[model samples]
Target chain A: MKILVCIKQVPDLESRFKIAASGTWYAAEDLAWRLNEYDEYAVEEAVRLREASGEGELVVLSLGPERAGEAIRKALAMGADRGVHLLDPLSHDKDPRQIAGAIAEYARGEKFDVIFTGLQSQDRGSAQVGLLLAGLLALPAVTTIVAFSHEAGLVTVRRELEGGARAVVKVRLPALFTCQLGLNTPRYPTLPNIMKAKKKEVRTIAVTDLPQVAALVRTEKLAFPDKRGAGVVLEGATSEVADRLIAILKEKTTVLK
Target chain B: MKVLLVGEYRDGKILPSTYETVAFARKLGAAAALFLVADPSDLPRFAGKLYLAAAQQCGEYNPEGHLALLLQAVQAEEPDFIVFLHSAYGWDLAPRLALALDLPQISEVVALAEGAFVVPACNGKLRRTLRPLGQRAVLTLQSGAFNADGEPAGTPQVAPLTWAGSAVVELVGYEAASRGAVDLSRAEIIVSAGRGIGKPENLALIEGLATVLGGEVGASRPVVDAGWAPHERQVGSTGQTVAPKLYIACGISGAVQHLAGMKKSGFVVAINTDGDAPIGEVADVLVVADLKQFVPLLTGKLGGV
Candidate 1:
């Protein structure tokens, strides 16, 4: 009944982002960091599964810079038994293959029954690592699962599809799942739990110590997307704004006319 | 370079994105072939070779089974690249095929640059150009990014492949989304709400505006996930891709997923407190105001229509 959950630290969605000087990624300084929203749901689901089983160990893992350890600690506070941090200063530069290869290298020997990860990270948004890790390990995998149930070593999951459709899939243990939004409500760490989590052991492994995998994809440049057009902005009193909007809709588009 | 396009077959028909993938391959100006894992019934008239695998052995949408068939196709065709639509099927299968073949993989490519691929990141605020270092790669094109127009008019050579692998996962069934009554795709006008609406009760303001405008109500993923709106009314990558005549987004800070659904609307309007919201990038009109006061006033003004 052992379970492993992979989490990532990303810039808070509300943070104002600035392009770095290199023009390959966002600036690292003056940014607030938090656990990726989707990964939080994965941690909550793993915590609930371990609690229901009443005996199994729940391990949390993260592959990112030093700040990612904070995300692991948050998961620990939420209810994981331990944490594993694959520390890399330049993790943001690594592509999905390199990231998944590092995780696969660490988890190869650990025979966990199930592995969980967010459907995608908020920053990269590639949505490739979990399935890539599963492929590297030769384990069956499902993505964007919103509903999950387990019994007798068989796991059934309802994965989200386009247009709000759900596909039910069943796979045996030694599998992987990418948790999506609306999967569950994550719990906030209370004071006592936060204090207790301070004692939890978090093993650190330098990503350099792991087998190096060459990045297949490289970022050539990063920039703000081109604006579609110069949009007319309306402001002032609500009544005046409403009047202007109506006039524009009638003149600019056919829907109102 | 040679290319392979994987077509997604679901619920007895091929998806439109399959042809869109063809449009992508044609953009590369390379020899291409199409692959599908289904019974040979009225196949598409691809200009290149078409590879078909029986659904009985592949089990229609099983990752391992499809991977096995695709692997065989790759061995035979020796394509330099494989392409798929960024649909649920492609999102699930492309990475598996990449890792199994030990090739680099890129997902959700929105545009093709001179020699790189452009992808949206950070909720569509940023775009990154990615170049593959490997000679071969797997790519999933963003849906609707490529248009299938003026398709080839000739039939393709059919090549049947066999799958001998065992299934690793079972396809149990599918649960239809609740409240299928609202079809936003057919609506001429859509008035959508987002988290800025504040609470479930605030949905009334959105509905009132929609009614006054003679349009259907739409919602962002957050609004739907919060249970403020039904799944059918959700508009986004995972919800619905719509191209209405007029799309008025009230309080919706457009996430990339949400923008993907409605970016094709003829005219876009966004009302949000933050003028810099991503929705403003695609909007024709940006109204910077609190939705609480603005929506009611707008609805009252439009009531005479």
Candidate 2:
């Protein structure tokens, strides 16, 4: 009952973002890096499954520059048995397919019984890698999973759909599920675990070891999203704000007007 | 240019997002065809030809079977561009299809201009104009970013196709969230609450306002994730895309994902304590006040009026 979880390091969403001089990506020098929110659930789920079964080697895999090792170590502190870091210096701008292909290259040899990933990376927001990796691996793939249960080499997951519809699916072993929020609350790593994680070795694999794939999408330029318009701000006390809002709704907009 | 628009349908109804994607494909002024993966019943006369891949497995919306079916169709009917709605299904399928076909793929496109695409990155704080460097490109159009009124006036051709693939997964059942029969997408007026509402009990003020305004209650993702509201009442990229006539957002600081769902509303009113909240930029009426204090006042005043 071996399980693999794919995690990525991302900048904290609350941080102020600055466009790089290249006008293509955000400047990373001053940003605070943390584990991606969705992948936190993925790692938590993997750790819980391992704890429940009381058997199985839980491997946390991440692909990025050296900074991503921090995220891998966090997963280790969260109770993963080992970590595999696919190290690549020029990995930031690669598209999802290329990233998934590199992962498949490494994953094909390991043959874990099940794989888990975040529904989408916070940075790309393409929601592509998990499904693409599943496709490349030719395994059963489910996305936006909120609830999961496992027994007897069979896994059942509840997936979140558009319009808030939910579907329960069952898949055989050697499957892949991309987790969404509300699946489980991630636990903070204790000081002892953090010390233990620091001692744990993370095996590094160079991206050059894998087949090179070119990016499909080319970014020409990046700019701030155009502001819609100047909104009339109602200030002062609570009553005044409420009064102004209601007055505008009744006088300017169609609501109540 | 030849465009292959992959259409999605569910529960015996064609998704309106497909029409919006078609509307975008029409902007390319290409010879477009919609490849539908559903029962070919009541097929709307789209602006272009329609091809149906009514495979049994595809009926339930599994990505594996749909990918294989669409791959088969793409090989047979090669097009310069492949378009899909950037909905739940599209986000899952486009990358794999592009990889298998060795084509370029872009997601969540808001605009197409002069062979370049406008897409959001860095959590929608920045927009990037991208170009496909491949011979053919697969794209997913952002929902509500395009016009839905571009279906041609004349009848289009319908061609039946077959898919030969196996589903690696099986759908056991579906459980619709209990949302008190409130479909936020169809609601004309929506009063949505955010985390600023503080607690689950504080939702009564929001509901009270909606009740008096004769509208439905929607919520931000945090509120829904916290169990203050059902997922069905959530409005966001992962929840529901809505274009209500009037949207009153209470305490929502405006995460880009949440704004993606309601930015198209006819009118927007935002209430939050922070004047610098991103919601202030998009809202037509910005009330910079604490939602806990402001909601009750607004509800009470509206009630008396």
lDDT for model 1: 0.88
List per-candidate RMSD values in Å.
2.0, 3.3
Error of 1 at B17 (Å): 1.0
> Candidate 2 on A1-257: residue-level lDDT in tens?
88999999999765677788888888888899999989999999999998988887999999999999999999999999999999987777787878998999999988888899998888777788898888788787888899999999989999887766778888898899999888987889999999999988789999998899778777788777776666788875477677777777777667683
Among all windows of 10 consecutive residues in model 1 chain B, the one with the lowest summed lDDT is B9-18
Q: Proportion of native contacts in model 1? A: 0.80
Number of the predicted model whose TM-score against the real structure is largest: 1
Chain B TM-scores of the candidates: 0.92, 0.82
What is candidate 2's TM-score for chain A? Answer: 0.91
Q: For candidate 2, lDDT tens digit of each residue in B1-305? A: 89889877766667777777677866788888888877665675575577777735465667777777787778777899899888767777787788788787888898876788998776666678888996689899887788777454555587777666566778777887656666788988999999889989999989998998999999999898878998778898768889998999998878767988899898898988766566876899888777777777888988888
DockQ in order: 0.68, 0.59
Task: Show the colliding residue pairs in model 1.
Answer: none
The CAPRI category of model 1 is medium
Per-residue CA lDDT of model 1 for B124-204, tens digit only, reads 778899999978889998888888888545687889998776788988878877767778999999999999999999999
How does the DockQ of candidate 2 come out? 0.59
- Where does model 2 exceed 4 Å of error? A190-192, A233-247, A254-257, B150-154, B181-190, B196-217, B237-246, B255-257, B264-266, B272-281, B287-305
